[model samples]
Target chain A: MSTQTDTRSSAVVAGSFEGDPRRYLRGLGGLLVFLLVWWVGAMTTQPSYLVPGPLDSVRAFIDLFATTTAIVVPVSGSDLVLPTGLAHLTETLFHYVPGLLLGASCGVSLGLAMGWNGALDDWLRPLVRVLRPIPPLAWVVFAIVWFGIHHTGAAFIVFVGAFWINFYGAYGGVEGVSTDLTDAASTLGVERDLSMLKLVALPSAAPQVLTGFRTSIGRCWMIVVGAELFGAPGVGYEIINASNNLAMATSVAYMFLISLAFLCMDVGFRLLEGRVLAWR
Target chain B: MALSSESSVDRESREKITVRNVSRAYDSTQALEGVSLSVGEGEFCCIVGPSGCGKTTLLRAIAGLDDPDGGSILVGGDPVTGPGLDRGMVFQEYALFPWRTVRGNVRFGLDRPACDCADCEARVRELIDLVGLDGFEDAYPKELSGGMKQRVGIARALAPDPEILLMDEPFGSVDARTRDRLHAELLDIWAQTGQTVVFVTHDIDEAVTLADRVVVMDAEPGSVQSTFSIGIERPRERTSREFVDYVARIRDELGSPIDTIE
Candidate 1:
């Protein structure tokens, strides 16, 4: 009897596994159709400069890694040549990583404090209400004045974008926690206020908190590209430079690189999130 | 077991719980009005009432999760001020932390200052087995059925081995068949633990089957209306005439004579 039940359950599992690959195939087929339409449109456009085909973009992307670009050395004030793709990509990450980490951490901590404590909510609500309305791009002037036209200035803008997303996510998550969970924790001997927050409130709000982190990551990526328009290093700067030089294919290639980077990071984060919240 | 053994001598001599004129009000609505009850060590008491009877409020008060507006509650002769480790509570919703596995949830109460790491794991394992959730130790609460989740909740509550257990409509959410099995399992655990249990439910039949004594409560003002002593033997037969009589008496006390006929 037990063996029969086991076989039935395993068959059900096998059925689901079969369904997954078919779903992936459908998704891949859709992407191919999209690419075909894009190729036809590019072929009809006058001058390859106006609308570069997928082949042109792909070639430009490969050439970017193989070729070098000359840049003025900051310390010695001498000309130096470096690999364009690697140098620009590293520069973007230097600012993006720091800004995202700093902003998300600060926002989540403050939001949790505000949501959990009535006094903190009252004190900070008005300030957040006033500041959150201002766009992250609006801080570019202040960024330039504070840190000059550098990676630090660009990073500051990315930080502003990431902050609000995480703040609201964590705040709403904490507020959504059911009172029954807290009461259960209390009876389970976690009577202290701090202990209750750590054990019950935080874990209960984790799904929301993780959602906030995921959103902030995507938002920060977009903001970093815009922020780099202010004379910072990275793919954004490369795209702007290529466009100015009328290298439309190169500009499009840089755009694709940014998207590819975002996709890789997003997949990595989703895997981590799956592992962290496996209990769900 | 070492913890229980050390406290066993003191446990036999002490009074389990004393609730004296405990009154709690929310705004103008009185949830509980001057309720008084005392339970002896190792006693199984069930509090039954109609909807909005404040049975849950009373159980929360006993667990020290809520403060009474008037009078006091004591466990083992000590005034109940706040939730303490000596009193464990099982909620109607099971309230198992969704993020924690069955064993992790059971280990939560034992991960206190009073318990060491190795001892806590042992106690968790023992409680998991006691609640018949041995193979499901690593399973998340979401993966379990309603009955299984409540079993985890019961194991979690029992892991600390409190002198008193306060449960608020614990098996009310499960199906009738599952609830019947749970009742038998609960009695077996209660017999082994020898802890004072105060269970709150709206089901008269459940009270009659499980309780040594039933405290019937009224709604609106929310006060204890009457008490009935059940002399039925263990592994109670629901179809038995004595059991039916006990259920009828409690239903009459609830002021619902029509329900008895039904």
Candidate 2:
């Protein structure tokens, strides 16, 4: 019996080490290996311009922060100079934050309402089904027509992309709430329909709703970059401009910047989610 | 015992529950049929039966969580229309909200318009202490054991100070030792509060152990088979001949084939 217990304890110890930290270390190792192979490939290539090394990309990234661009102020007709990196990044965030906030809030509210209320679900489901299939980029022409070639137009496109993801998230969350929970609340004197929804249904659906929020955060970042590809001043536009000018290293640098920004946002959101769902 | 043969009119005046000709059906299955029983004020009544028996259905109907197809259920001389604050129920699964802390779950029912803030807080704290969960008030439901979770369930049910406490197989999930402890605690609470309790269970020993009167029920259109009064006093010895006799009688009435086979 003691020997069997020792074997079981050893197995448990082995199982614990097999998770999380080891997996993270393996991921980091794989990334380093990939970078090494890319660097080697770049050195072996025929021309340096075709495949700039990792060091060249890092230099280009630094240059973006140092470089300034001169633009004529539209309203004042004055020469205004700004760092290209800061200006483009600020422009992207201006649209991205407001658009994501607006779309996510509206979508979650509507989705929860529709999921909770049978009448609202019947009224809105068909319209949503018809509209959901049309891609957000398809609204670019309409956005440009309505808001013109400005921040609002780009924001509108990003909103369209984020809205659908949040809508589905909240809808599924509310639908997934077990009937047993609602009955429990009813016995606890939360019998009114509105109160039941508020007290029981909403909290029960929070994990799924938060999952929707997290997913939309990643999705909005992707959409914002795509939205900026069309005459909008963001990292995506910088990448296109650099590649067009045969500065492939600069293009790759901007791509890395976008990825870094996404990683920061994703990690931050995951931490917040962990704190909120600590009970689970 | 003398109260059992009293007319409906006289019994209704003093009894906490007067379930008369109550019947319920789910689609094609007759869950309950013409079930009638009366529980006196502050009486501890346990309904025992086999699987497929409509004990849970009857308890749910009494709690006003479900509606009966026919007949009337009266609590304190009023017809049970729907779920109200006057009836508190403890579920078998210990349905304490996962997100809410022990205090928060207990406070759920106390946040009504009828209860003042200070009084509600005091009552919640009192119940937390009464259920032997004073130190763990801030702990979430997931952090608790099966027995501890059911204690939270009891505390949450008692928070509103309801007159009628309905428990459906509340200790069925707990181990025997934990269940024994819970039974003692529950009886103490019941004696202190003077609340009418209608407990449903499949375990005959459990019914005999906890109930003042053991109500035996038959399945397949579930109806009351017979009623046995347990005159044995509090903290009743499980090994006592009287206790064993009560358990055996109830088991026999419940149609347990173990005794017959032996």
Candidate 3:
């Protein structure tokens, strides 16, 4: 096992970012290939009701963009969106931003707290076990009742999906910090609170936090759709509206946008992770 | 038992550290029971023993990294309760922060408000230069060799000019060649600074070569088996008869004097 790991590390070191092109271009190429396959398969399908071609979806998107003049949730029955494309995107962003910020922040804090304290970690483990099994969608009813069809309703869904992953990531990162670093700090006379955390704890846990943060971002995208399905306005709502009106092409168009958004976020996250973890 | 023995060593260089009957245990096992030792200011003392003999626990207590269930350690005549700035430590692993550069690691001890005086920067630079890391100040621990990282560790420990330096097998992790080079550097640093150093090692040669007095501790429930004062002069030859005799003496104490392991 050790030999295998050593071989893998040496291989990685030998070719690690050395004349490699696993950059944005690779991501774009994959995206284009996926879309091309999707496009071809859609064109070939005998019954296009379930799968509209990319061109057909775009046509419906343009028509929806040009025609929309007012907006609300698909369930709200306030049909026409004012200058539709941007408006719907902005509405989705509103829910996503709040959820992402609140959920990620709280999750990170909880993870740090739990990882640092053994008592808290042991106490919360069983609680997390119980809470984690409950799907984020189970909270939709409470989301609607408590938030009443607002962005908060959508945000709650996203938060549920994201919070636990980040919490656990942060916990693992903090717990894995090298005892040597702590010993070094103690010897150097750094016995204070903030200094200890900054010097020894946080930096040590960074890789774990980044992994958790990245994982949470993916979960947030999933939860946003669940949020939209329940009474919140988003790209999901646009799809729901187009479907009920029997405009399957527009529904496909909305879905395309959701996929595009998630793809863009994953790419952005990888870049940020690379930059932050770079030791210099 | 060992503590009182050290207090009365009485070859004064100002009595910086005084240990009093310090005992430590883990669950049912005693690592150190009724163990005590002291170091006068400017003394180079080495604690040598077999593995699991609580040489480390003794060093930890002096640094306040571990608390003795009984007795106390007085650093510059103040009782030690917990880890503090008065004592500096160098671990076997070097313990340099992986994320920080060599200079950054050294600056850790220098960050205290007390150390932030006008001389702090110069003091840090001098130690950095003293450790022979003149050009690699900006290099992080990951980029460094084992010996280099330990140099950073040593430099950081010395940056604050603490009254005592508590080293726990600090050179144990380095290669033999690097360890030899570092041993010379450490002795030179000790001669110049006169910092009270309490170094622990299992290697008898290291204990004899670097110490004014090598305190030998027995295994299991570690006790100070004997203290051998090296009367040999500076730049002592490891190949010489005197050096071999010192190693032989410690070797004899470990088993039957008649049939001891080399």
State residue A32's C-alpha deviation in candidate 3, in Å. 8.0
lDDT of 3 by residue, B167-251 (tens): 9999887778778888888887876666789999888888888988899887668778888888888788999999999989887
Tens-digit lDDT string for candidate 1 (A25-107): 98899999988988998999887688888898999999988988766544365776778876687678878988888888888
RMSD of each: 4.0, 5.8, 6.4
Clash totals for all candidate models: 0, 0, 3
Per residue, candidate 2 scores C-alpha lDDT tens digits across B1-262 of 0224443234324789999999999998888999999998878899988776799999999999899999999988899999888899999998888889989998998886457887788888888888877777787887777888888899888888898999999998988877888898898788777778999988878888888888988888889999998988878999999999988877777776532332
Q: How much is the lDDT of residue A196 in candidate 3?
A: 78
Which sections of candidate 3 miss by over 4 Å?
A1-40, A54-83, A118-126, A193-195, B1-13, B114-119, B256-262
Q: Which stretches of candidate 2 lie over 4 Å from their true place?
A: A1-24, A68-82, B1-13, B256-262
Best by TM-score: 1
What is the CAPRI rating of model 3's predicted complex?
acceptable
Which lDDT tens digits does candidate 3 get at residues A177-199? Answer: 88777877887877876677777
Model 3 DockQ reads 0.32
Please write out the lDDT profile of model 1 over residues B151-250, one tens digit for every residue.
8898888888887888999997888877888898888788777888999988888999999889998877889888887888878998999999999888
> Per-candidate TM vs. native?
0.91, 0.90, 0.85
The true-versus-predicted C-alpha distance at residue B87 of model 2, in Å, is 0.4
